[model samples]
Every structure is written in structure tokens, then in C-alpha cells.
Target chain A: MPAEGGQQALNGAARRALDAVERTGRACVDSISAFGYGAALFAESFFWIFRGRSIRQPVRLTMIFEEMMQIGIVAIPIVTVLSLTIGVMLAIQGIYTLSLFGAESRVTIGIALSVTREFSPLITGILVAGRSGSALAARLGTMSINQEIDALRVMGINPVRFLVVPPLVAMMVMLPALSFLSDLVALFGAGVYVSLDLGMSLPAYSDRVIEVLTVNDLLHGLGKSMIFAVLITLVAVVNGAGVTGGAEGVGRVTTRSVVQSIAAIVITDMLFVFVVTR
Target chain B: MGVEAVNSDRSVLVEVEHLVTHYGARKILDDVSLKVYEGEVFVIMGGSGSGKSTLLRYMLALERPTSGSIRVLGRDVVRSRPSELYELRKKMGVSFQSGALFSSMSVGENIILPLKEHTDLDLKTMEIMARLKLEVVGMAGFENLMPSELSGGMLKRAALARAVVMDPKLLFGDEPSSGLDPIVAAAIDELILRLRDALGMTVVIVTHQLESAFKIADRMVVLDSGKLLVTGTVEEVRNSSNERVQQLLNRRVDEVELDPEAYLKRLTGA
Candidate 1:
């Protein structure tokens, strides 16, 4: 009887181990399929951008303009303040560290390169992700809950065409523009600090910044911002369009959208830096 | 159970065969079948969670069943591509439970959206069409109001205006009388009947309100626990011999003999 009990226990352990493996496999498959579904949705949205007019359901230019106003123009004050603050702090730290070695003037080089090639774009991406991405998810999730999306489907209108493409087109256009503005504002901020702290002339600081900044640095940051835009919009649209369970589900999906967009931005930023620096 | 054949002379606009649907692992609809005739108000009534809404969604082609054939307007909705489905949907209209008006758009804009998407009509003509629908729904001057600004009944009216703005050949309403006072609910029922008579549109509704169902429906199918209990005219359902149907009609509580062991297991999560 004891031997039989021992065998039963062994069999139970093996079965549990197999069950765990099966569960893990299924989870992986679910995730992969979800990712594939998201990709298809993204592709369909993009396709609608080009083909909508032929079907007489064009993505309205006025709608795109409204999105740009919401996503870009309305965001200006916050972006400017945050980027400028970071720029001043970076300059202060750069001067203090470099002055220890009697090389404080090289602070201009550090500020110009870092602000143009990295900090400005990264900050703008994160701001947009947190602000617009969360809003998109909430709006879409609520629409899903209210049956507005389903209503649109039954009306023969494509939600992606009417909803997703405007924000996406606006993001692609606005992210690069906003990054350029951020780079300029941050440099101006650093220039102000240099003039006040080091008793330098504004023109001299401007000359130093211009000498250090390359066209490629500007282009690279703009490119990164564009990719970040795609990531933020994609995550928000997917989460929002797929919401279930009602009001609480909207909150859950909105949080998930912001978190996922930020993570994607950071990881892609790292990959970008590794590639470009190499 | 009281089951009667649908009027063959009217011609069927929607036909479902052996439809089965599951929500995750739980069966929501089991081998259900029904037919809706053209130019008639066909109601699907049941207790909550009886899969009436699910069946409506299937007929709309908004969702696919696990196994079934659904023919709507003579097209096999199960296998239609998205493009074909959209084309089919142009002739159909649905009013959701809670209005579901696009919050961002004004009532006028909401009503004209389908026109803007599908037609090349000038702005003036589209606005005229929207105004006409608004007048029909008794909200002629509320075009500039946002959805949030409207009361619940007004919202439903605006939603109804949008649904019929395209003059669809078929209309589906999911619980149109819900969440309203009895008077307002009756008004909605009256408007639905008017739409059918005025526009010559076939109507399908999923509702649990027996009064509104009886008032608007020419024929209906009553469902319980995802199973169809009766499909007949109002009098047939009212006189159904099935105990469950009688209980539902009388609004009486069901009495089930308790199994103590099973009850204990359920209570204790065993």
C-alpha cells in the first residue's frame, strides 16, 4: 500500500510538471497571436491612409489638423518648460564637472551633442507617450464599452480609418517637428545658463553650440522621435480598440498603454544609441 | 414549449441555423435557430444573459458564432469578407442600448457620418438629410447640442436619428426602451412602429421588456438560459404551456430543488 501511494505521488508530480509546461506554452502562443493581431491592425490602419479616398471614406484633412492641434500645438508649453529645465540642469552639472579639470568651456560641446542627439527627443517621446497615448487609450476604451465602435462598424464606417489614421498621421508629422523645437529650446536654455554663470557673451555661446551640432545629430534625433511616435500610437490604438469588461477595463487598458509605450520607447532608444554609436 | 412556424408568405430576411456561441469556455448560446421575416417587427425577448443580444450581434455579422450559418439579406454573413460585410451593412441600421453616439461629434454630425463616409453628397445636402432625420425623431432643434449635453431619452432619440439617417432597408434595436421611464419607453416603442410603417423598413429588436416587445413585435422568440423556449406571436407566447415560460410571463421566482452536496461544494469553492 505504501509503494502504491509513493507511485501515485510521483505520477502527480510529473503531471503537474507537464501541466506547468503546457500552461507556459499556451501563454506564449497567446502573446504571439495578440502581437500578430496588433500588427495586422496597424497594417490595415496604414493601408486606409492611402486607400480611403478611393472608397469615398477619406481620412479627413480637417480631422488630421485637429489631431495635430491636440497632439502638438496644445503640448508646446509643457514640452518647452520641461526640456528647458533639464537643459539648464545638464549645463550646470557639465560646467561643475568640467571646471574641476579647467575645461569648463567644453560644457558647450557636451550640451550641444547630448541635447541635439539624445535628451530632447527622448524627453519629447516620453511626454507624448504619457499624455496623448493614455488619452487615446481611454477614449477608445470608453467608446468600445459604450458600443460606439460597434455602432461605427454597423454603420459601414471603418473605425481605424475614422479614428486611428488621423492620430497616426498627426503623430508622424508632429513628433519630428516637436523634437526640433525641443532641441532649439534646450540649446537656448543652456546658452542662457552659460551667459549668466560663466560671464560669456550670448553670441560666443551660440557660436560654440553651432560648431558642435551636426546635421546628422539633428536628423538622428528626429528619426528617433518618429519611431517613438509609431510605438506610442500603436500601443494606444491596440489597447483601446480591444478593451472589454466595461469602465474598469478602460482604466486598466489606459494604464497598460502608457506603461507599454514608455517601455517600448526606452528599449528602442537603447537599440538606437547602440547602433548609431557603433 | 409553444413553437409556431414563421409566416412563409412574408419572406425571410434573416435566417439562423443551429447557432452555437461560447464566451471563453462558457456556452452563451446553444444550437439556437430562428428566422426573421421582411417588413415585420421581430423581437427576441429573454431574461438577462439569455443570449438575445448575442443573437442580434450574430445577425448583424458583428460577431461570428462558434458553429452556425447566418444568412442576412440573402448573404452568408459567416463567410463574407470585411469589404462585403460593410457593403451589406449599408442597407442595415442598429441602435445600441446606450445611444452610443460619437461623443466628440455634435448630434448633427453624428447623424450625417454614414452619409459622409459612403456618399459624395455636398455639405448642404448632407446637412439637410441630418435635419430631416432630427425632425423625424422630434429633436429638430437639437443638432448643435453635444451628446453629453443631452438627457438619456434625447440621447436615444439622437441615436435613432443616426440609425435611420441612411434610410436603411432593415433596422435593429438592442434594448431601446431600457433605462427610461415607462412613458418614455412607450414613446420609443411608438417611434419604432412609426419607422417601420413610414419607411417600410424591417425591424428586429432584442429586449426583455415584455410590454414593449408585445406592443412593437409582430412575432418574437423567447429564450431562457441560452435555449429558445418559444417562437410565436404575442398571444401564442402569452398562452405558452411551458412552465418556465409561464413563470417568466408571470414574473414568478423559479423554484429548484436544492442538492445539498452540490450547494455546499459551490458555497465552499470545492
Candidate 2:
């Protein structure tokens, strides 16, 4: 009887282990499937953006502008504030760390390179993901629940074209602009800190920044911002369009969109850094 | 259901054959087959969870069935490419139970969305068309209002305007009167009939409201537990002798017939 009991216990442990393995497998499959769907959505949105006019379904300029206003213009203040703070913090930190070696003046290279190549784009991406990505998810989720997406389909308006493409074009236009603005503001912030704390003149600081920074640095940050924009839009749309279960489902997908977008941005940033730094 | 009476002269617009659908392991539509004739008001009526809405979705080509075939406008919706479906959908319009107007756009913009997408018509012309549709739905001069600013009845009217704006050959309404007062429901019924008569669009409505179904439908199908129970005119359905149909019509609840062994198993979580 004791032996039988031990066998049963061992079987239970094996069953639990199997269940856990199955769960992990299921989660991985779900993520892969989600990624594939997002890719398809991205492809379709671009197809519509580029080829819609041939079929008399030209992407509406008005809708794109409206989306630009929502996703880009409305997000300006927050992006500015956050970028400025990051810039100041980076200057302070760079000064302190370099001062340990009595090389505080070279903080110019550090702030200029880091802000242009990394901090500005990364911080702006996070802000947009939180601000616009969550809203996009919630809006599309509510539309799914309300059957507006279905209505659009039945009306012969491809939801991807009518809905997704405008925001996509807006993001393409706006993210780089926002990132560029973020870069400038952040540089100005760092310059302010350098001038006030280190007794550096504004023009001297500007000359140092201009001397150290390359056009590639600015373009590289802009490129990363555009990539992040696509990532945010894709993640937001996938979660939104997949919503079910009414209002509660909308809320759930919105949260998931923001969380997933931030994760995507960070992971992609790491990959980008690896590639560039290599 | 009398073998789905065939009208030899009328062209069939929608035909479903041996349709089967499953949500996970549970069958939601079980080998259901039906046809919708052109230029008729056909209603699909069933209680909640009877797969009526699911059937409507299939007919709309919004979802793929697990098995069986659906043909809409002579196109195999299940096999059609997205471009083909879009072309087919241009001739079809659907109004969802919740109205489903784009919340970001005003009613006028929502109504003319189809025209904007598919046509290069002048903005003035589109606006005029939207206003005309709104007038037809008794929502005249309300085009500028947003969906969230409207009442339930007004919202449905706006949705109807949007649906009929393109003068689609067929119109599908899912439970148009499910959540409204009798007066408003009756008005919606009148609007559906008006749209049919005025625009010559065939109508397919899914509803469980017996009175509304009976009032609006020229012919109808009754579904129970994913199985089609009957397909006939209102009078024919009223006279159906099937026990379940009678139970439904008379509002009688089935008495529980418990199997002692099964009950014991359930109680013990066996």
C-alpha cells in the first residue's frame, strides 16, 4: 500500500510537470501567433497606404491628419517634458561619473552621443506607446465590441485601410518628428544644465555637441523612432482588433497593449543597440 | 421545416448548406441549412445562445464555418478572396445590434463612409446623399450629432441610414429591436419595411422577439440549440406542432428530468 501511495505521488508530480510544460508551450504559441497576426496587419496597412488609390480606396488624407493630431501633436507636451528631464538627468549623471576621473568636460560627448543615439528615441517611444498605443487599443477594442469593425467590413471599407493605415501614416510621419523634437529639447536641457552647473557658455556647449555628433547619429535615432512607431501601432492594433467580452475585454486589451508595446520597444531597443554597438 | 420550400422563379441570394460551427469543443451550429430568397424579408429567430447571431455572421461572411458552404450573391463566401468579398460586400449592408456607428465620426460622416471609400464623388454630393439617407430614416437634420450624443432609438436610426446609404441590394439587421421600448421597436420595424419598399433591398433580420419577428418577417426560420427547428411564414411557424416550438410559443419551461446516476456523479465531482 505504501509503495502504491508513493507511485501515485510520483504520478501526480509528473502530471503537474507536464501541465506546466503544456502551459508554457501554449503561451509561446500564442505569442508567435500574435506576432504573425501583427505582421499581417502591418503588411495590409502598408499595402493600403501605397496601393489604395488604384482601387479607388485611397487612404483619406483627412483621416491621416486627424490621427496625426491625436497620436503625434497631442503627445508633444508629455514627450517634451520627459525628454527634457532625461536630458538633464543624463548630464548630471555623466558629469558626476566623469568627474571621478577629473574629465567632466568630456560629458559633452557623453550627453551628445547618448541623447541623440539612444535616450531621446527610446524615451519618446515609451511615451507614445503609453499614450497613443493604449488609446488605440481601447478605441479599437470598443469598436470591436460595438461591431464597428464588422460594420466597416460590411460597408466594403477595409478596416485596415480605413482605420489602421491613417494612424500608420501618421505614426510614420510623426514619430521621427517627435523624436527629432525630443532630441533637440533634450540637448537644450543638457546644455542648460552644463551651462549653469559647469560654467560652460551656451555657444561653447553647442559647438562641443555639434563637433561630437554626426549626421548618422541623428538619422539613426530617427530610424529607431520610426521602427518603434510601427511596433507600437502593430501591437496596439492586434490587441484592439482581437478584443471580445464587451467593456471588460476592452479594458483588458488596452492594458495588454501598453504593457506589450513597452516590452517590444525595450527588446527592440536592445537588439538595435547590439547591432549598432557591434 | 417543410424541406425549405423552393420558389422556382425567385433567385436565391444566400444559401447555406449543412453548416456546422464549433466554439472550442461545443457545437454552436449543427448542420443547419437554409436559403434566403431575393426581395423578401427573412427573419432568423431564436432564444439567446441558439446560434442565431452566429448564423447571421456566417451569412455576412464575417466568419468561416467549421464545415459546410455558404454562397452569397452566387459567390462562395467561404472561398472568396478579400477583394472578392469586398466587391460582394459593396452590394450588402449590415446593421449590428448595437448600431456600431464609428464613434469618432459624426452621423453624417458615418453614413457617407462607404461612398467616400468606394467613390470619388464630390464632398457636396456625399453630404447630400448622407442627408437624404438620414431623412429616409426619420433622422433628418441630425447628421452632425455624434453617436454618443444620441439616444438608443436615434442611434439605430443613424445606423440604418448608414446601412442604406449606398442602396445595397441586401440589408442585414441583427436584433434591431432587442433592447428598445415597444414604440421604438415598432418604429424600427416600420423603418425596415420602408427601406425594403423604397430601396428594393432584401432584408434579413435576426431576432428572438416573437412579436417583432412575426410583424416584420415575410418568412422566417426558428433555431433552437444550434439546430434549425422550422423555416416558414409567420403563420406556418405559429402552427408548428413540434413540442419545442410549442414550448417556445406558449412560454413553457421544460421540466427537469434528472438522471439519478448522473446527478450523483455531478454532486460528487466524478
Candidate 3:
């Protein structure tokens, strides 16, 4: 009886360990499956886009235009304001630090490089993640709970093709444009700081910015914005697609969409940085 | 309208055999089997939690059964490929209980959604078809209004318009007359009759409203506690002497006579 007890305890310990590993394995498989679904959705959307007028003209045009207005046009003022503020702040800090070595004149190059290459795209991504991403999640989540998704299926319309593709296409096209706007506004703000605060001429500041900014820098930033846009759209749509329950479920998934978007954006940004910097 | 006429030409459209379903560990439907013949309005009536909607969802291929085969329109929905399923769905339509109209779309657009997706009909033809469906449902002028703008009755009618827009061979309605006044509900019941007459359509309606059930059901099935208690013509079901069926039809709550000894054992966790 004592030996049997000992063997049973050992079996219990092995079972516990096995269960812990199985739990982790299940989580890993779940995450990978989710990613596979997301990638398939992304690829299918691009396929529909390539097919062009296969979708009715008015529907496709209206959807893409509406999404562009939401993701890019409506976002202009805030993105502009944020970029300008960051640009001026960077210039102020750069000049102060350089002035310790009497190199305050180099603030123009510093402001142009940092704002153009990193700040503008990152901030634009985060802002769109909060605004458009949350709205997409909430809207889709509510439709799911209301059985509108099922209605679409019963109607023979693929919900992902009909509802999600336009928004994804819009985000892809708009984020890069917003990033460009951010860079322009930031450089202009920095130009203002250089002329007014640092007692340098605007032309001189422009000259320094022009000298340091290269096509590589522009490509790097714009490329990052595209990646961020993909992250935001895929995360929002995926989280929204999986939503169950009711109104509270919609809210929960909206929050999850925002969180997932930001995390993915940061990780992808790091990968891009490592590639570009190398 | 007679049972013999229906059974004489009975070509089964939806065939379910030994179906079982579960939501988590709790069984919702158990070995329930039924047949829906073409060109008849088959009503599945049950009290709440009796798995009527689960059965409807299975027939619609919205939920998969744990152990069964469901053949809809001669296609095995459980084993069909997605492409095959899509083709099969194109031949049928389902109107959900919630109306399930696209909120962002107007009533006209919602009705035309199926046509827009499946057919290359010109906009002019589509518009005419939408208006025709709306007129049939007694909502002719409500085409321009959004779903949110419609009353409960109007919403149901508009949803019906959408469901019948394609004039599918089989239509599955999940409570078309629920939550409306008797007059409005009666109108919906009549609309179902009109759809059958106009389209030669087979309909499967799931509802708890006895009045609606009696009005349109050519053949009816009564479900009690996830089991089929009776499947017969409307009059046959009305005459059923099954105690559980009687309990449902009369709305009698099953009275539990409790024993203190059993209650004590349950509470003591023995």
C-alpha cells in the first residue's frame, strides 16, 4: 500500500507537469492559428482588389472613399498638430544640448532626421490605432452580435470581402500619405524654431534639412507607416471578427483591438528599425 | 391543404437523422429527427430552452450537429466543401429572428443586397425588384428609409422582402411574427402564405406563437425538452394526448414535488 501510494503521487506530479506544458502548447497553437487566419484575410483582400470592377463600381468607390476620409482626411488636423509640436520640441532640446558645445546651429539637421525617420510615423500609427481602429472593432463587433454577419453569409456575401477589404485598402493608402504630411508639418515647425528661437534664417535651416534628408530616410519612414497600417487593420478586424456575447463584448473587443494594434505596431517597428539600421 | 395531398407528393427537402447538439457540456438537442417536405410551411413549436432555434440553425447550416447528418436540398451540409455550401446557400434564404437587416443600409438597399451580390441585373431591374418585394410585404414606400427608422412590424416586413428577394426554393424563417400586435402578426402570417403561393417555396418557420403556428403551418412539429413529442398536421398536433406536448400547448409549468431527504442530500454534497 505504501509503494502504491508513492507511485500514485509520482504519477500525479507527472500529470501536473504534462498539463502545464499542454496548456502552453494549446495557447501557442491558438495564436498561430489566429495569425494564419489573419494572413489569409489579408491575402484575400488583395486578391479582390486586384480583380477590380468585379465588385460593383459604386459600392467599391463609395466604400474606399469613405474609409479614406476617416483614416486620412479626418485625421489631418490632429496629426499635423502633433507633428508640429514634436518638431518644435525636438529642435528646442537639440539646440540646448548642442549649445553646451556651441553647436546650436546643428539643430536643423537633428530635428529633420529624427522627426522624419521615426516620430512622425510612430505617432500617426498610434493615433489611427485609437481613432479608426477602435471604431472598426466596435462597429463590426456590434454587427456580429446583432447577427448581421450571419445575414451576410446567408445572403451569399462574404463578410470579409464586402466589409473589411475597403477599410484595409484605405488604411494602406492613407497611412503613408499621413506620414508624409507629418514630415512636412514637422520640418516646417522646426524651421520656425530655427528662425525665431535660434536666430538663424529660414533658408539656412531649410538648407541643413535638405542636406541631411535622403531618399532612404523617406522610404524607411513611409515603409514603416504601411506596416503599421496593416497591423492596425488586421488586428481590429480580427478582434472584431471573433467577438461574441453582446454590447459589453463589443466594448471588450474594441479595447483589445487598440491594445493589439499598438503592440503589433511596436514590434513590427522594431524589426524594421533593426533591418534599416543594419 | 390536405395531409394526404402533401404526403402523396412528398419530396423531402431537408432530412435530419439522429441529430444531437451541445452547448459546452450540456446537451441542447438529443437524437431529434424530422423531415421537411417541399412546398409546405412546416412549423417547429417549442417552449423556451426546448432547442427549437438550435434545430433551425442546424437546418440553416449555421451550427454543426455533434452526431448526425443534415441533407438540405439534396446536399450534405455537414460534409460539403465551402464552395459547395455557398452554392447550396444561393438556392435558399433565412430570415433571422432579429430581422438582421444591415443597419447602415436603407430598406431598398437591404432588399436589393442579395440581387446585387449574386446577379448581374441592371440597377433599374434591381430597383424594380426591390420595390416589388416591398409592395408585396405592404411596405412599398419604405424603400428610402433605413432599418433603424422602421417600426418593429415594418422591420420584419422589410426583412421578409430581403429573404424572398431571390425567390429561393426553400425559405427558413426564425420567428417572423414575434413581438408584434395580433393584427400585424396575422399580416405576417398571411405574407408567408402569399410567399408560398407566389414562389412554390418550401418554408420552415420556428416560433412559439400558437396563433401564428395554427394559421400557416401545413404540417407542424411540437418539441418538448429537446425531443420531438409530436409531428403531424396542425389538427393532429392539436389533438395530441402526449402529456409533455399538452404541458407546452397549455403553458403548464412542471410542478416539482420535492422531498426534504433528497434536498438535504443535494445540499450536503454527499
State the displacement of the C-alpha of residue B36, model 3, in Å, after optimal TM-score superposition: 1.7
In model 3, state the lDDT of residue B261: 95
Candidate 3: tens digits of C-alpha lDDT, residues B1-270: 356565867788998899999999989898888888889999999988889999998887778889999999999988888668878888898888989999989999999989987888999999999999999999988999999999999988888989999989999998899999999999999999988888899999999998899889999998867888988898899889998888877878889999999999999988
Candidate 2 error regions (>4 Å): A1-8, B1-6, B264-270
Docking class of 2: high
lDDT of 2 by residue, B1-270 (tens): 443445656888999999999889999999999888888899999999999999999988889899999999899999999989989998888888999999988999899988887777999999999999898888899988999999998898888888888888899999988799999999999989887787788999999999999999989989999999988888999999888988887888888998999999999999
Candidate 3 residue-wise lDDT, A157-224, digit = tens: 77877888989989999999999999999899989987998788888888888899999899899999
For model 2 chain A, give the 10-residue run with minimal summed lDDT: A49-58
lDDT of each: 0.91, 0.91, 0.89
Per residue, candidate 1 scores C-alpha lDDT tens digits across A121-228 of 999999999999999999999999999999999999888888898898899999888999999999889889988999888899999888888899899999999999
Q: Which residue runs of candidate 3 sit more than 4 Å off their true CA positions?
A: A1-30, A51-59, B1-8, B261-270
Using DockQ, rank the candidates from best to worst: 2, 1, 3
- Check candidate 1 and list the clashing pairs: none
The candidates' DockQ values read: 0.85, 0.87, 0.54
Best-fitting candidate, scored by TM-score: 2
Roughly what TM-score does model 1 have, to 2 decimal places? 0.94
